[model samples]
Target: MERKHFLKSLLVGAMSAPALLAACGKDDETVAPSTDSTSSGSCTVAPTETEGPFPTKVPASYVRSNIVDGKTGHPMTVKITIKNANNSCAVLSGALVDIWHCDAEGNYSEYGGTGMQATNYQSVHFLRGRQITDANGLVTFTSIFPGWYSGRATHIHVHIYSASGTSLKVTQIAFPEGTGSAVAAVNGYAKGMNGYTYNASDNVFSDGVTQELATVTGSTSAGFELAITLNVAV
Candidate 1:
């Protein structure tokens, strides 16, 4: 946001998360055009997400899991607003974001097959897709709470796209502790699931504090709001 578009890795395990992003190279932030119409200033107009060290192990085949990624799909109702740190108009309408995550039991659908135990088959492309922000730089979609799987912790992957159609696969987001419902269904239903802690130990969220990192919102009256800041390169 400082120069052209704001983007940077922002980390090292030895240092703090915010400090890391500060250390990483960041692009200048861009604003939305007045003629457009999505909502207000929110994510950039670039498509795709800023990819990162986040794993890219897509399976040969996968089933739709409990959650679907991106800004479209089954009506899950998610309002994604791309704005600057001040919550002003970051206005990047038409930007594409590539999002992906796990199901409640933490199993991935696409990367498995007959070779591995069916993690339940999917009816469609759940947890994978691209979201294009509206003219106002806001994009909303439907999706469910993603499940947790092995090795990796609970989190979401996102990549950014620039106006030039360049992809900045660098930024990512995560859910903070005391977030989401502490469900018994996942641990009980899945063989390997149980006692999934919401600590910062997980690889995806070890850094614990960055715009890419997620923090939980909402309350007993509503579901959780996994809020995060995505510095887009547009």
Candidate 2:
């Protein structure tokens, strides 16, 4: 879904820090922090300062597609909406967000390779890129459904950018669907069946994230809409 930063490029956009922070995507969308759960604000800003890789570059031809071989999305395309964390959160308009993920068969090209290494693609940036949020601090991309590996559920990696193209926060977002956790009940992974959704037991989305980042939704014809929330600890 995205890539890593080279030297952390941050080209501060023209929006004022506070005004820019006000327009981050968090406002209208779900998954806001507890204090702002019902509060609707753009939720766009990211961290402002960093030490290492900051605003990275978007990889070549990082547009949406099936896979490296041009595989089309199964039921529909994977639409990712990257918005500024929250206005005043620090005007991350020009911040770079890098993404990368696996194919429909749990295989990552540049990083993990295949087979035994299937679960560790973090070392590489396959479907990676650097997308700058608009005035609203939002960037959307169309991509294919990611497949699951042996030990991990389907997921996408995201790295947020701060002011001046500094790498502020680096985290990953994943989808969970399967029986037992409504994934199976909704997607019908129960009764000895497999589906795009995993369970509440998915490993990738497992650290203190109880329905935090991704909100799973299913469509009979559109496959799934794995809505995500990227909240930097800043």
Candidate 3:
């Protein structure tokens, strides 16, 4: 498959924090919760997944809560909590959490004009940011509900690291069902629900989504909220 081939090719150069500091840098539900891991008390270790083709090369520079970067779509607020699987699920405060995703039109910033993505957003950075986990082991980002791509479901890529910059995990958050309708509701997304791939068919999610699935709440009209707990061995 083209998507699988592309993913394999990009694996070597996936984003990392030590590269540079000058690089750039969600939705609720009309949907059901995919798994129980969203609960604050769940300690199941989150499944590590690929960071995908696009990642923020210089994550350290974009350390803000709002990663919208002027992109327009239904509003979304993403909350992620980090927990240590090796320590009785204790909150892993001070971990670095970095996230990036496609915009409402399924195009990623800082990348485009390639065989996989052709939108040409290489000049600007939007929908990408990094935040350090707070005392509560949580990092929140203000963003827009992501749109679908040809072979992947609606999702977000996350990279976690220790406080001292040691790499911990590279994973992703999968959206719940009913995400198609939410994508259709986006104003300028002409693709609508035409070529969307659901979690069941997604290469990264097909095996299972029990640990990576997120709990989404809210609606297209009022925007949405996503909350997920990620447990990693520290």
Candidates in order, TM-scores: namely: 0.55, 0.55, 0.80
Off by over 4 Å in 1: 1-76, 83-89, 114-124, 179-199, 219-224
The residue ranges of model 3 lying beyond 4 angstroms of the native Cα positions read: 1-42, 179-188
Better of 1 and 3 by lDDT: 3
- Tens digits of lDDT, candidate 1, 108-136: 44444432224544433556555666676
Q: Pick the candidate with the highest TM-score.
A: 3
Off by over 4 Å in 2: 1-69, 75-91, 112-115, 118-126, 176-203, 218-220
TM-score of 2: 0.55
Candidate 2 vs candidate 3, TM-score winner: 3
* lDDT for each residue of candidate 3 in 164-210, tens digit (9 for 90 to 100): 99987777888877535443355236666765677777767777777
User: What is the alpha-carbon lDDT for the whole of candidate 1?
Assistant: 0.44
lDDT by residue (148-231, candidate 2, tens digit) is 544344556666655465655655555555443323433322223353334344433433343235665665355655555454
Residue 166, candidate 2: C-alpha displacement in angstroms: 1.3
